[model samples]
Target chain A: MYQTIGEEIQVAGLFKKGRFWPSKFKWSGQTFNIQKITLTAEANNGGVKLRYYSVLASGNLYRLQYNRQFETWRLMEIWCEG
Target chain B: MKGEVGLTGLNHCLSDYKDCWAHVDINSYFATLIQQENPALRGQPVGIVKESGRTCIIAASKEAKLLGVSTGSRKDEALLLAPNIRLIPAQFDFYLDATRRLKRLFESLSPEVQIFSLDEAFINLTSCKYLYRDTHTFGTLVQTKIKQELGEWVTANVGISWNRFLAKIAGETGPKGSITSINQENLDYKLATTKFTDVSGVGYRLEKRLKAIGIENLYQIKLFSNQELEKHLGPFWSKQLRKMSFGEEPNLFEHIDSNPHMKSVGRSITGYKLCNNETEIKQILYNLVLETASKARSMGLAGRQISVYLSGEGRYWFSHVTLPSYVNQNKEVFELVYHYLYKKWQRSFLVIKFGVRLSLLKPETQINQPLWPTWHKQRYLEKAVDELAQKYGLFTVRPASLLNGQLIRPEVTGFLGDKSFQLGS
Candidate 1:
């Protein structure tokens, strides 16, 4: 069970804008900050599928991937990006 | 075909120096070396166990690994999986010797060598272009020489790329006991197939998270725009991972440290038994200050920041104070930390661990010209203390406060910059 309220959390996680920024952040929220996150591929029947996720935070979870050909972030799962 | 990634949690893109880097890691080097030295162990199940009362296998041979015995598994659990498994205690000295020999070999190959650890190094092979046909040939020769001269005891997975970040990834997912050049040749294919953990900088925790996200391979991480990764993962991890994907290196450490100025110097003791009294705790902290201060004196360095940590009852308390001026004298650090700890701690009898940390370190730049006669006397006394400790052993003089039976503590190897105390050879 997670109760998100009135907690001061500081995270040394990376925050990406266009590239990478070393984020030393302090945020007051109801949840633990981004504890862990990763970008990897899903091996499927057809081909490789790109994926993304946040392991620590819960509220704003999204599933968008980078399409090299289109050169854009494509949303695969609606709730993943939210 | 993947090689050993060596240690975990390597941040790839944080380098500040060069563009290209080479990470030549031994492929299951310890286990492989052990097996290779004894041919019978080859093709047999073997695991490297740490020296402990109970067996904790750190690395397993590929064959043993196939039998489902691997790193971090208890010997009992491994035996349950493979009853015929051969367990060997970690030969850290041998591994250290091998690592030093390998480092010497690397130095001969190139003047610039970053010895990351026993089994891994970041080599700047940029200037040695004419010496070898190419990076591939150079990597091959390195691998061959290690195998031939080092008693065929180990094999290396060499990653040659434009940066340490990419070079690490290349070495990690490259062929076993071979080299992989992540350039125009096989970057895409490599990214597409390699497991997320197989990437150089990624770890088990990150891999699990990535897999949960439905992204389980390297190509997907490469596919994400740096912006999206930052927004989702935050700046630090996003930047590091992006660098890993792009094969970028972050030269975080300054290569030149002729007069290496330390950022921090401190000692920590993992308590076997908690100190019961405040006096005992203070004594332990003072001892650490003395030991660390001796080191500072040895190196002619001083620090402005003094920090302390106390852990007990599933909680940790940390406090730090900066001095007005740089001071490496043990008294100053001890006094500062003692005050900080006194204010923050409960003075309860349930303390389990004590640690002292010193930071904001710098060389003693200013010459002493004391205005007060007392101050001049103190300066001379401090110099005498420093000289005595340098000439004799470190603990030749001890503060009277620490004489109470409470302050004497157990030995902690590697506490005072003793490299010999390292667990990983």
Candidate 2:
């Protein structure tokens, strides 16, 4: 099941190959270790360019958004596997 | 006929900016998007449903399609066919965002781009076609660009042709990663082999109608007189078929269209279960009204005609009427529909599906400014609400009556009926 969780989160990753690769994220007082970055896309959020990474962490899916203008990270949404 | 068409088509294409157009179609759109997001689902049979607990599979991944679990199959049937298949809910917002970025990339590559749908677009490469050497090379470069910029696993097919019709036909015929082209030289041969239904806009119903009249081949349609085809297929389609046969764009995207207007703004929903409750029905109707009106307002459009439709197990209800004044506000459109349309449907009808459409569209400016200051205040309030909705979400602020019920999510239509609404946003 998937649920909307649009909250600012702390994220750590490497900016490699001209793109950011998020490897870990902290949301709702819990840490999720990223397993793989399955898909990526960039979109304009109210004139701010934000790159999105749909990552798999602990067998669950999370959409990690990084705002380029503000230099902030947000956990946009999540899909949990039962 | 070929000689005449070749000469005229050459001249038309030479001067048309849409000359050497390329149709870019994402492969197995929804399924692939899901697979691209989840690592465990990659290389596995995947089916995308509208949401959890929904049974019908709207899309199937390449693996699932290869396994014979067809689209529109029940979840149970899909399990039987591919037991290990994963089912994911449709993520229309994600799809739209990705599509927007893809369109931006296409726009960067070409001067003119037409956003056809969430998964497809037509790129005009006439001015820059020479830069990539040939159509095939250009297509390959686009595929590479998609992989490099979008995602490594996500891929798209490129179809190049002289016109929109031929380009779309070429795009739909090839394999997921293949680059196909149709031009004047191969146009006749392609038409001879392509099925009537395979051509865009020719659905099964039209195919059955054509078959009823013994017209089997797309190329052979030219052999029949216009009167004979019109007698059976109606004049609009008869003309359309002739245009398709010649690979001519019938309308709209012939020029570089950035702000194409919509003929209508509509929203419809099919519930997961049959709903017989009046309150639930009203909520659904309200949701539909809110969406259609919001779309109209955002585009600075208003409609004088409102159509409401509903379907039960054995009955269908429809109402279409014109209002004295054009309306683009959600509350105004909702009141008209609720009073004239929904209220008339029998309470016990057991609605399985419902829809509302706002047509006879004109610019909001077409309506005269009302004499009341309250009306102007209401319009300003609505504009503020719309701006907030655009920034946050569609349902960021909604009626209290919809507080308990599940909010119906507004999706970007796959056919792109409202081009400016989806593409501009």
Candidate 3:
């Protein structure tokens, strides 16, 4: 239900000492629960790799690709399923 | 085939026996008037409305008629048929003033003047034979006067015939901005081909009925025996229908009424972003009341019923209130509307247009003076304000409360109450 035509963003707890610094978290003086996310493929070419898996937002379309070796994702070459 | 040709010109001894009559019908009078006033509207499908609403089209130009749009057609229906049709609101007061001014021009040409409506009229040129050498010369003079006094944009189709019906038909079929006639010659040919509905007496509904009965042409209806027509259409209607078919005259006396009265006084303003504030709304109401009341005073009459209408932005939330007592006072009308506005509208920002109407009125003398001090004082204050406004001008003096920013003022709401509204006795 959280899926959109472009970018999908997510945040989760990473600390184990009963405390953790939230990355890419929107703070409104309150905590929010994470939900399932999905993104649409780029308009053309192969999926671009990202340091963190993130989908292309708007304007020129590009897909999200992840690198298993670096434990990160980056938008690499432009790719589209269609 | 038995049409008379040049009889009037040849037989001067029996000119009185002939008694030539003529009518000048303005093609699409209201729409054409607007087009003549604004050149941009020329050659477009124009529809005029008595009030801006979904309900009715008061008049339509020739261009509009071709699209199956007509007078009294619902605006929504007209729009569906011709989306690009131009819509114009009826300015009765403007037309009335122009009618009066044009009548003066007609009076100069002929002693007998009969105003058919705000847009059309007939002048009896029978008594004024000495004014011009021929009927054509006289028509040209009348045409010149109208063009000179009223704008050149306005045109009339002049019909010089023996009687009113033939003249009316002549004017209806004539070319734009010129004089034409249905004379002894070609009368049958004109009537034969013309649609029954296009004739003045037979409307669309009757035309449809006539066609269903295998009477598609006016000539066929004319050929039917009186007893045969009477058997199908009954006595009174058959008589009238037979007149239309035979090119005979109808009962013109019953049709013509002389005294014209203003039915209602109203004012509307556009371009006010729909407003939610109470004070601003009241100011618009006040201005409308002031204008209406002043018109009442000018016409020597007062309104007993006051109507207030507010249209929400883009055709949502439309409501109207009609008050019972005739009021020509601004304060009285505004106070009534104030209560309605306060009750219905939340202080939300969404009002685009507003209007006030005073109707079901009698003469100013008929304004009842109640024994209550508040009512009497309010009435007096209103009378004073209306008087002052007439002498000086609108907004020359107004309540301080009405100066608030929430009030909507439209560009068309020129200081002159000369066009948008008028009071009727």
Highest DockQ model number: 2
Model 3 lDDT tens row, A32-57? 33221112111101112222222222
Per residue, candidate 1 scores C-alpha lDDT tens digits across B1-425 of 22233332122221222345678988776787666544446687887865423367878887887888878898899999888887765544346556667777888888888766557787887676556655556776898888765656567888776666667777887557766666544567766776776665577887776676566675677777878777767788777766656555533433321224556777776554556676777778888887677666656677878888888877777787876777777666777888755557666446777788777777776534337786557667777876664444344556887666534332322112332222211
Of the candidates shown, which would achieve the greatest lDDT relative to the real structure?
2
Best first by TM-score, ranked: 2, 1, 3
What interface root-mean-square deviation (Å) does model 2 yield?
A: 4.2
What class would a CAPRI assessor give candidate 2's docking?
acceptable
Candidate 2 lDDT, A1-82, residue by residue in tens: 5677889999988989786788898988999999888777666543356688888888788988887876889888888665
Model 2: lDDT to the true structure: 0.79
TM-score of model 1's chain A, to 2 decimals?
Answer: 0.31
Calculate each model's fnat, 2 decimals: 0.00, 0.33, 0.00
| Runs in model 1 lying further than 4 Å from the true structure | A1-82, B1-20, B27-101, B134-137, B144-152, B200-213, B225-227, B235-240, B250-260, B273-283, B347-353, B366-425
Model 2 regions more than 4 Å off? A1-9, A13-21, A27-30, A41-52, A58-60, A65-82, B1-18, B250-260, B387-396
At residue B40, what lDDT does model 1 achieve?
45
| lDDT of candidates 1 onward, in order | 0.60, 0.79, 0.58
Residue A66, candidate 2: C-alpha displacement in angstroms: 6.5
Q: Could you list the chain B TM-scores for each candidate?
A: 0.70, 0.88, 0.62
> Which docking band does candidate 1 fall into?
incorrect
